[model samples]
Target: MRTRFTWGLTVNIMPPDYELRLKIVKNKIAGHEVSKLIAPEVLEYIANNCENDVRHLEGAINRLYAVTAMYSPKEINLEFAKDALKDYIGSSVYITNNIQKIQKAVAEYYDLTVESLKSKKRTAIINHARQVAIYLCKMTTEETLDKIGLEFNRDHATVIHACDKIGESLKKDEELREEINKIKDKIMN
Candidate 1:
């Protein structure tokens, strides 16, 4: 069976053997394991690179254990790990899809009949629609500022500024907030 693990911004699958390796790696990194010196950098490197299959992650952990000379590591309890992994993957997918839906809905709401929201345009209504799309994308997506900028053909800083400007206005401008809320409700439902 497979499980999931999250280390801040990154989420990945963790196999049953992960806990066993984690304990050994933790001890080794703390310099408590005699006759073995597993560097902390090794675990960090693996975590950074291993973000796919749990079996592959287990292999990486196994290699770490072998290098550290930690023989006969305990078996990991798979139940909790499996649940955590599922939650992480599900939540990540949910967030990503919802953001995409929000972007689509914003485009449709503005009635801009463009084939792609990312297409180039400079008219006032198109610009307003683009700003609203950017605002919704910012509010919903986990995409980086640079990625959002590229999506809208603007600088990352411009995306940030748009998000901030809209966010501030939404807080104090009741009519604008209401309009946004109505749009969001329409999209969500």
Candidate 2:
């Protein structure tokens, strides 16, 4: 927190609300010819259920960009929206299930709180707990990287990085292996 940059101020932006999120998606669609391709209902669906992340909206739109280019669908209706955005929206995975269980196990094993695991804190102890949680979430659950990211307020790329970091360390570190196994055992039971 000392002298990384001349200005190291961090400003957190809250995720947009329902109407603003909808407007953001609609505006994004209109920026291209996507408004023509997508039905209003489909736009509404993306806005309503893309959760509270602006990046999720961008990701959903980017995915739409890909899907429309690949399939060249006639119209992006509700069905098309659901199909195209299946990886983006909906209560597909729940907090009471795989992710929460893994976070609880890892936090307990590390003597940290589940909130700390999901928090922006990057202390060595907290960061290690989060990385382990992400690794276990990847190995144990059938959830997508994006979905796992939602639980920790991280993006999919960060999730992938955490997994890779833990994986490489696991191959070379016996103490870390035992640490991970102990956490995994906590999760399984």
For this target, which candidate reaches the highest lDDT against the unseen true structure? Answer: 2
Worst 10 residues of 1 by lDDT: 75-84
Worst 10 residues of 2 by lDDT: 88-97
Candidate 1: tens digits of C-alpha lDDT, residues 1-189: 233444346756554232334344454445434213333333422332333445445555554445334343333222222222332433432234344576677777777653456667677767666676677665444555677777677887877677667655654576765556566656656
Candidate 2 residues 96-153, lDDT tens each?
2488888898888999999998889999999888998887776555567799999999
TM-score of 1: 0.45
Clashes of 2: 0
CA error at residue 127 for candidate 2, angstroms: 0.6
**Candidate 1 lDDT score relative to the true structure:** 0.51
Model 1: residue 106 alpha-carbon error in angstroms: 0.9
Residue 15, candidate 2: Cα error in Å is 48
After the best TM-score superposition of candidate 1, give how far the Cα of residue 32 lies from its true spot, in angstroms: 38
Model 2 spans > 4 angstroms off: 1-97
For model 2, what is the alpha-carbon lDDT of residue 119? 89
lDDT of 1 at 142: 50
